[model samples]
Target: MKAMLEGLEYAPEDNAAATTAATAETVGYAFSSDHLRALERDGYVVVDDLISQDVARAAAASARAMYDRGVMQNLRQEGRDDDVAVLATSSLPAGDEFAGLRPCVEALLRVPDDLRRVVARVDDDALGADVVSKVRACRAPDRLMLARYGSESCRYVPHLDNDPSDDANDAGSPGLRPSDRVFTLIAYLNPDWDATRGGRFRAYRPGVAADAASPSDFVDIDPILGRVVVFDAAKLLHEVRPSFHDRYAVTVWTRGAELLPA
Candidate 1:
């Protein structure tokens, strides 16, 4: 197998030093040294207010429109009200219904260059430390937006983003090898969410279960808009609890680069 990243720009002698130094000087929402250390140790970290209210509202509006249109066939078939939950895998909806959300997705992805830079820095650090780097040459996915309507029936069961089975070699999903994910970034777009509203993201730590572990090892962050939670995608097992009210957010996952056929 050939290395997934061959012509990429990460080099320790020259580029890594410059990247590390440049990251240290920037001023914005960032993970503290202590927090970074914690993440390195426990596999996750959370930064509050990563997105602004204007951006959150725009994304929310777009999500709501998409939900109303019944883009997610799974949710509509259950006869659940539109507000219950919405999940957008790639980009924003394109029709007139989701026109407003296009800008919202673009703005959300582009607004925090500094934050994006920090994440890149962290990705580089993970690479250097021999941590599994899942997605190479990718900053973050455009958006994995979700909007939950006022219903408790739309709960996401606990699960890991990556396949955990060791028998992947024998599985039919060719070219897709089993991998241990290193990081996940989740940003909440709902400003009014709280513990009482439910739908709080619950995580269980490693070793908590013989079969399934949770992501709440070191921290349990509430679903607050502008809050970005970065955690070990493998060790941090998590689930979205049901919500009595509406809930909205954008989620992104990062993993170590996968082995590719030569």
Candidate 2:
């Protein structure tokens, strides 16, 4: 609950009330108006030590157990050759894998909805007046997921979560929204993760030209335990770098209800 945010940007003095607005009941993650603006401007934010080490370890065990229990399904059939297994939270069952970790998972899932409401009030884009209409409207997000990545130097190539940034998405299924996703939230569960083992998460700034982007244009986030990352899904290109050791993540994708005003 004590969020020592590692990649937080701009806790500006103008909107100082941001800190007070994000009460525990409104947002358990301690997201401020600054965090919301960071998402809009820089495209990402990283929070470290968001949970206790013990809780992170327990979540890691549960994620691994789910994979061992055949609850996690492979992504090979979807066409990519990466070694990844994922399961939706709605379909996730109650068992030893989720005994005490369920509440945390549920809380993590609710962050998007809660955060949107907070932003809609404190932030200018998230702010409101009787004559003005809301620019960013929060919508129902897709189901939360628990993902386990294999340890055999498996890498998921760089790409945006919601490519094309529209409703006409390719993962064409009534239940899936590979295009409407507005924001992506990921929590690392590996309490003892080794940084040298790789699998660092990377996020790219919006490409200004067709081929002008380079390595320096992106930011890399180490997948350490108790670390949570929130980013703009459609705006920033991201990827899971190769991992020599395994990785566990709880991910939630928030849906985009309206186009952000320019």
Candidate 3:
């Protein structure tokens, strides 16, 4: 696991805990202890001023341009015609408009040791030695998608990024077998987002049934510029509130140990 995070195929026998001891810098936002603590306790955290507003605006324009040009398709759900995205894990061309979004993207791709430790300590007992090792071993994310939910009363129904039942078994022995997402990082691109716009990312607290979740069990965050939301991909039940205006964002899906560090 340690070797995997270090961009290696293998390593000599040693404590996996020792692998992530090396430090990684955060370019988009300072990952303070408070931020990490919030994630450990709440299963999610929202970051403000995540990236420069200028960059976020540029990204939004580029994403919308691409979507308008037909590079993106409608989100694969029934009746959500306006909601669209580039869902593939394809590489962004060098010097493309999306380049400025890289800092926040890379900051998340390079998983921090502190974050690994926090996730390892989650009360879910299924995060046994094996699953915890993958959490510690994972150092990179595998998918980055640019998305837009257009105004037309568009809303995404509740869904989990990864199935909780598959978490313990998501990482197979020795190399990338089949992979499931472990975390989701969404960086909003709209700078002048109005609170009255109505598109908020609402995620329920851990353990609440999505179908039966009460208003008191969730937190709703505005999709504003430089705002980034990250959370446990499998455990948190989340949905997109009805959007009154076009909503654009860059989304990163962390595939634990599925992608060896590059």
Candidate 4:
């Protein structure tokens, strides 16, 4: 959506059609019947093992290493900037610490194809077809970030990500007008996390007025390794509980609009 990839300009020169084809060929993952039902009913779904345990572990390790190296800069939320930060993908080059996780990034790029399928299944024929076409026409996001939440003070408040129109993002950047973003995908990287860790992810019902402190009327997801959570970025109000243990996640967004002129 936002051409500014986490504060750095990155426009991949790959052929769009070819990239889409490749994505379709490689992404064998899909939401189960139960998960699909949950998504339609609750606006979110937690799909375990979206990627292999090995891949998730490797990615988490790589991301944590980057965080330790000070590659991530503070994220600028409207009220707080210390809770989160963008993991500078620019600092990661091939054959570096993040090299092992490249396949995970590519897999994430194919997520829109899965979303198109979900749209087809849940929406009416006309609307589903239109949404599918729009998703197909959208370009994959070039920027990937290791969004890290601090163990002590950092906690993401409940908020919607983006809508079709536009809104400011967590990074305190201008929103993506005619917004292409569709879903929010967060792949948990906490290898041996538990409820005691207190970094649980929660998704609320649509139109709820709850914030981080009052999250009783919601679904809580554990930040365990290899768990990928997908949700309607524009519709769901979600937040992360303050963690006792550090949390790491590979966060990316899926687009649903036609590509815009550069």
Cα lDDT listed for each candidate: 0.49, 0.61, 0.61, 0.63
Candidate 1 residue-wise lDDT, 153-191, digit = tens:
455656555546544423433222224334566667676
**Whole-structure CA lDDT of model 1:** 0.49
Question: Over the full model, what C-alpha lDDT does candidate 4 score relative to the true structure?
Answer: 0.63
Clashing pairs in 4: 75-85
lDDT of 3 by residue, 1-262 (tens): 1221122222211212243343223342245546655665677888775566776777777676666656667746553444444332324433454355445454445444445656645654533454355456554444467777878877887767666454444554432222356667788988689978888898888888877878899999999987888777766778888998988888776655534533
Q: 182, model 3: CA deviation in Å?
A: 1.1
**Tens digits of lDDT, candidate 4, 1-262:** 1332223222332433344466556655455446655665688888885678888888887777666666677756553323333433332334456565655665565666555565556545433343345445544555556777777856777667774333433333222322445667788888889888887887887667674335457878998998989876677878787788888888776654443335
RMSD of 2: 9.5
For each of the candidates, give the backbone clash count.
Answer: 24, 1, 0, 1
lDDT of 2 by residue, 118-234 (tens): 555674545233111211443334356777677887667677777784445656654356775667778888766777888888787767332456768877788898788987776
TM-score of each: 0.62, 0.74, 0.71, 0.75
**What are the RMSDs of all candidates, in order?**
9.2, 9.5, 8.0, 5.5
User: Which 10 consecutive positions of candidate 3 have the poorest summed lDDT?
Assistant: 4-13
Where model 2 places Cα greater than 4 Å from the true spot, the runs are 1-29, 77-88, 123-136, 140-142, 165-168, 208-213, 256-262
Q: Where's the lowest-lDDT run of ten residues in candidate 2?
A: 1-10
